[model samples]
Target: MKRTEKKRKDIIDAAIDEFREQGFLGARTTSIAQKANVSSRTLYNHFESKEALFEAISEIMLEQNRSMQPVAYDPSRDFVEQLKDALWGYISIITEETAIGLNRMVLSELIRDLDRSRKFFTETETHDYPMTQLIGEAMDAGVIRKADPVFATNQLLALAKNFFFWPEFFLGENPTPEGVMDDCIAMFMAHYKTGS
Candidate 1:
């Protein structure tokens, strides 16, 4: 990578660590500069402000996990196997510490700055995530039946997260024990497959 690109990456990493540890409100440009081993001026040279840095954070997370989606149901794979693969993939990526920390930081920002949070939520979640598209496809294909795809998408994500993942973040340990991924996938599949 070019020298400028490397410095940009360095600043981004530093910002992520500070934002995760201190949140948007509490995170300091000085601390981020220290972590990046750059002057504060250099940090600003890459990103004009903390909000811009947070926008970079949002962009990075979305890019990395963009492909994390429900497996398009294939005739070849059995329903259970495909469901397990799709749901587990989504949950595992989104439930990681980095992802969770991002969410918490954004949520905190939401409380302080409703307009920014709402705008961020709409742009990022609506365009970047395929949550609605995934569930809608599942419904159209008869994998799941007679449901509001938007509501289903939200609830299913919340179920996997709130029931299985959030506490883990708060406690500083993921609760996904042995086979929990499989079990969680199966449990949600059970909901999706309930006979119409």
Candidate 2:
């Protein structure tokens, strides 16, 4: 990577740690610059302000996870297996150490800034999420009962997050409990699988 790019990455990494430790309001750019081993001027050259840096971190977090290839729906595959694969992929991404810390920081900030939270959610909302697309295709292929794809997608995610994400997010639990994913899939299939 170019020097500029490496420095920028270092700034972001340091900012993540700072924000995670001190929060958006409490974090200071000077601290972040010092942690990154860059001058304050360099930090500002890369990111104009602390808010800008925070926004950049948020964007990078979303982009890093969204860059994963979308799971394609295969008609010949078992619906449960396909759903399991897609759901696990998502769970893995969100449960990563960095992702969890970033999410905690972002959520805390968003709670105090209603307008920013709205903008963040609006910007991030999309129909192309892997599970959503997989469920839509499954519906079209008669593998699942016809329903609102987004709602079904939420149901699946809610189930998985309750076990895999919320506990970890709130209580710092790591390594999802055994059988949680399978149970989530089975419950979702019970509700949505075609001919169930």
Candidate 3:
């Protein structure tokens, strides 16, 4: 990697650690620069301010989320299996240590800043969510009942979050509770499956 790019990455990496450890309110730019092994001036050159750096970190985290392998609908596969795969794929991404820390950091800050939270969620809502695509495809192929793909996607995600995400995110639960995925899939299929 080029020196400049490496420095920028280093800054982001260090910022993540700093933000995770001390939070946005408590984290300092000088401490981030020291952790990154870059001068405060260089950090300023890359990021105009601490808020800018925090925004960049949020963007990077969302981009990483968008980069997960897209799960396409498969005609030959059972809808339950396909949905399970899609949900698991998403769960795996959010449960990663860095993702958890970043999410916690972002959530904590957003709770204090309603305007920023609104904008952040608006930005998040604009993404072409992968599960929505999969559900839409399944609907098109008659594998599942026709309905609002986005709503269906949200339903599945809500279920997963209740069973798999919230515990892990708030309590550091790991490996997921047994049968949680199956229960989620069953609840989703009960509502959305063909002929339901």
Candidate 4:
């Protein structure tokens, strides 16, 4: 990588550590600069503001977990099986240490800045995620009853969040219970899947 690019990456990496250790509101750019071995001015040269830095950090987080992006829905495939694969992939990504730290930073930001939190949520959850598109396709193929794709998406995601994400985030609870993922898929399909 170019020298400038390396410095820029160092700044973002340091900022993520600072943000996770101290919430975004509590973190200081000077601390990040020191940790990155760059001057505060150099940090500003790369990112104009803390919000911009946070955005960069989010992009890095997404790039690191790009494998979690769901595959395209295949109408010929079993809907429940496809949904399970997609949902489980997402759960695996979010449960990673870096992803959980990012979630904590975002949730902490939410308490202080609703607009920023909303932007983060929209960027991460609504726009890029493939689950909604799959749900919509399932609806079109009559594998699932017609409904608001977003609502169905939320329902499926909420179930996984309740079972695996939120509890682990909030309580440091273990999410390794056997059959939990399968149970969530079964429950969701029972309610949403359509019959002949």
Highest TM-score model number:
3
> What lDDT does the true structure give each of the candidates?
0.72, 0.87, 0.87, 0.80
Model 3, 1-196: lDDT tens digits are: 9999999999999998898899889999999999999999999999999999989988987897778766789888887788887788788888888888888888888998999899999988877667888899999998889999888888888888887778888999866775878988888888887887
Tens-digit lDDT track for model 4 on 121-162? 666653545587788888888888889887888888888888
For every candidate in turn, the CA RMSD to the true structure comes to: 3.2, 1.7, 1.5, 2.6
- Model 2 alpha-carbon drift over 4 Å, by segment: 174-176
Clash pairs for candidate 1: none
Ranked by lDDT, top first: 2, 3, 4, 1
Better of 3 and 4 by TM-score: 3
lDDT head-to-head 1 vs 3, winner? 3
lDDT over C-alpha atoms for residue 193 of model 3: 72
Please give the ranking of all candidate structures by TM-score, highest first, separated by commas.
3, 2, 4, 1
Q: Which stretches of candidate 3 lie over 4 Å from their true place?
A: none
TM-score of each: 0.77, 0.92, 0.94, 0.84
Per-structure clash totals for the candidates: 0, 0, 0, 0
lDDT of 2 by residue, 68-180 (tens): 67777898888888989888888888888888988998889999899989988887775346788889888998888999988888888888998899888999885677588
Per-residue lDDT, model 2, residue 44, is: 97
Total colliding residue pairs, candidate 1: 0
lDDT of 1 at 156: 64
